[model samples]
Target chain A: MARASLREDIVNAAVEQFHMFGFTAAGVKDITDAAGAPKGSFYNHFESKEALAVIALERYGATRGLAALGDTSVPPLARLRWHFEALRDENLAYGFSRGCLIGDLATEIADHSEVVRKAVQDSMQQWCDALSGTIAEAQQAGEVTKALEADTIARFVLSAWEGALVSARSDKSAKSFEAFFTVVFGVVLR
Target chain B: MARASLREDIVNAAVEQFHMFGFTAAGVKDITDAAGAPKGSFYNHFESKEALAVIALERYGATRGLAALGDTSVPPLARLRWHFEALRDENLAYGFSRGCLIGDLATEIADHSEVVRKAVQDSMQQWCDALSGTIAEAQQAGEVTKALEADTIARFVLSAWEGALVSARSDKSAKSFEAFFTVVFGVVLR
Candidate 1:
């Protein structure tokens, strides 16, 4: 229906603005204006900004997960590498204009917004879980270190990747990503 | 003497507000109110909110560096562990309400504010340099692996710690910090 499409538009706009300006700085008016939707349409779709943020976080997590899972035909380690490369390209395309949306929101609202905080927590856990699966497969394939437990190594890899993203954002350079990926995966492969 | 004290108070207040509400959401009024300084006094001391932020960031970095250095009387590896433990306790005491001020500001303003972005980059590089020195000392003392260069390990440690903070903030738990430190350092020592 047209109404549902409008709602999706509003949520997408909110996610982009919220990622750029953060939850407190990005107002409902700004989201509506960016979406080209009437103000009433925003309220009609979501009860409040907090409610809207919760939905936006979910959408973002789902979309990113699907994109990262692209072409399962590739070997798990190579697929994982592809995912990081895609992320690097996306960050560069944006001119390093934003770090991860989940990261930004987690830092900004984690202490205050319980709903938003849970959404971020869930997204990160899900990411760790997905990476864990790939790592387990790699271990079985003898493509990665078998000495470390799969789950533990997965968590380490995820944490290192997130940290590299933060460094990349701060420096406005993708070199951090390159260095991190090389060192982390290099150790496993060796 | 009074002028120096007032300026320090303003910078401290701005750092607190920025940590709580981020760069864009935090305003001059919020910082001035927190400092108990008059509005005119704020403008007389700083040209703009961005100017105040830069000074506050420098103060924050210096304080954090001193805290991280601690006593330095213990063994090299032990000293490094203690530094992380101190950071863990600080986060727990704050109820994880605050993350690294530099990390928070870098995430929020790096994309949009060139001055703030460069300040964060410079501060992070300084932090990396400091940590690299410690790692080099530890390696020379046979406290860690020499297979990886000290600077590479330094980058890994710093990035992992930052990521652990993000995970801690999201999960509302310090377990991520503990897990990351144990695994990364465990591997290094082995």
Candidate 2:
């Protein structure tokens, strides 16, 4: 039980470093230092930095206040909007310094780390799958255009969203994200 | 003349490293070694790795097939589509491996490197400015909806497109980018 909790601490510490410095730039020593754990503990828990990043990506998602997005109880577009708004608020709270971990990894490490790359791909797939379900519902309810498949539209929405986050981070402001939310909710969806 | 050419070679090599390995992961030694220049020459030219990245980004954008996007001689929607299509083709040519350099920096380094971060912000700003011009022209011609400012719509399009590249890199396929092209041209533009 103690070991499991220590493992959680390691993962949690890793998320912050990876969030701040990227997967490759944030060394294992930094992660262990942040966790207050011995260097051996890092090796005992994860095989490589790539392994830790895969886990970090999941841990970041788990705590990002997006559980409600997958509830399926709320309307599709509303849930989608809620997810974006929450991200916007969180990003603003961080002063736009901390963008999405998975996105950061996807951009920087996807070409280099197959393990982390697969994890990012899976996370995105998971998000798209959940989003598509809601978008399908929206389409059936005549809330969205049916010209494209639920999955494809979901992909489109999700992709544009990732781009918006990048824009927000680059500008160090939420206007890019707000622009995304506005265009998505106001024009793209309509 | 020799010095000028040597500087160009350094930027070109650094871009490949940055494009493949990211800004932080691509070491200065690697960049200089790739350039066939003395490792110490790197410091003589740029104050920091962040400084080189700013220039690398500009060179990458210069080589991309987007010069005509700002020409204004072409129709607005046509220029916008051409801009995206050229990117899609470039990504496809790289087998969906080399994504946008500015986006890569925006995702991976925006928080840590202010120099690189501001450079990315400027690049996105320049793209939006050019895109807004074309979009505004399209709106005047009734080619696009006049419901929103060309700048906002341009921001939306640019953000979504950046997200699409992330998606494409995650999946190791161009389908996500192509989907973006389809949605923007078919649905969003209409």
Candidate 3:
């Protein structure tokens, strides 16, 4: 494989492992083998497994979470709903066996590892920023209500969705995901 | 320590380790050392580290999580708020360095370990049950909306609080927790 393709392959493989098994429990050897890359090349591309894991989380959010939130044609609140629905679908796709890479890493990765921890923190902030912007627009249009500040509600909505994902993964059920949507739309915003 | 006290100490130590280091990364040796007990004594009390980890999770929930939800004097939603605020305070005590042990274990512990996963699942269900009862009462009192089912709302609130905890640990800030409370009470319950 070409150099660029090999690097991308390694990162993709690592992200899959981190999603399935957290950043800490997942072995680098398994990651490399999945990528079909040699062990020596993993070091050449990244400083450590933790570094690759961070990259994986950011990439996943950009492609999956942020992409849905950034869709402008959809109404702002609907876009927010879309973002969570996509996540719920993704979790179900995994048979509720795994969870968000960022949320999982924040809980599983060692706190002593500053770099990895910061990466997880930053990724979460990025989602809040994305959702917050849409929430601001929704508030202006009266779709989300003006009772609370856009930023605060945005953060709260993010927490509920993430928490719902936590329950989904732990219980291996879709009940938490469905219930989360009902409250957020049928009650909170309504 | 007496044999029973020694077992309690070991379990308490294991709980702390699981909170700090997660289920898979935390070692048996460290749990014993933290308990100031011998390694040999560990297996004598518990069949495996997995068994001990499950017990630790159950114990923590009884004292911290379920206890707050089970408080009868407080109104339903306020009791739920109390439960999350208590958790937020506990996280701040740790400098926002760790997260829920059950959440961490659900993502960290290997999926094939059915016993440990079931323990995490059941503990979550227990909280959902406790919250659902209070929610039904609140709905009857007109404190919460009649639009959503009490059981569904209960599950969503729990997920949101748990998800907020995830963010609190990730950002090392109380922002998510504060936002969670504001919207949950001000919007959903209102």
- Top candidate on lDDT is 2
- B97-142 in candidate 2: lDDT tens per residue? 7689989988888887888888998888988887888888899989
Q: Write the per-residue lDDT of candidate 1 for residues A95-143, one digit (tens) a residue.
A: 7767788888888888788988999899888887887787777778778
lDDT score for residue B149 of model 2: 83
- Model 1's lDDT to the true fold? 0.79
Chain B TM-scores across candidates: 0.92, 0.93, 0.92
TM-score of each: 0.91, 0.95, 0.93
The better candidate by DockQ, 1 or 2, is 2
- First chain of candidate 1, TM-score: 0.90
Q: What is the TM-score of chain A alone in each candidate?
A: 0.90, 0.92, 0.92
Per-residue lDDT tens digits for candidate 2, residues A1-190, read 3465788888999999988888777889998989888877888888888888888888876765556766777777787788778877888898887678877888887877788889999998888887778778788888888888888778888888888889988998777887787777886665
Of candidates 3 and 2, the better by TM-score? 2
Kindly report which residue pairs in candidate 1 clash with one another: none
Best by TM-score: 2
DockQ of 3: 0.74
C-alpha lDDT of candidate 3 relative to the true structure: 0.81
**Most accurate candidate by DockQ:** 2
**Root mean square deviation (Cα) for candidate 2:** 1.8
Docking quality category of candidate 3 according to DockQ thresholds: medium
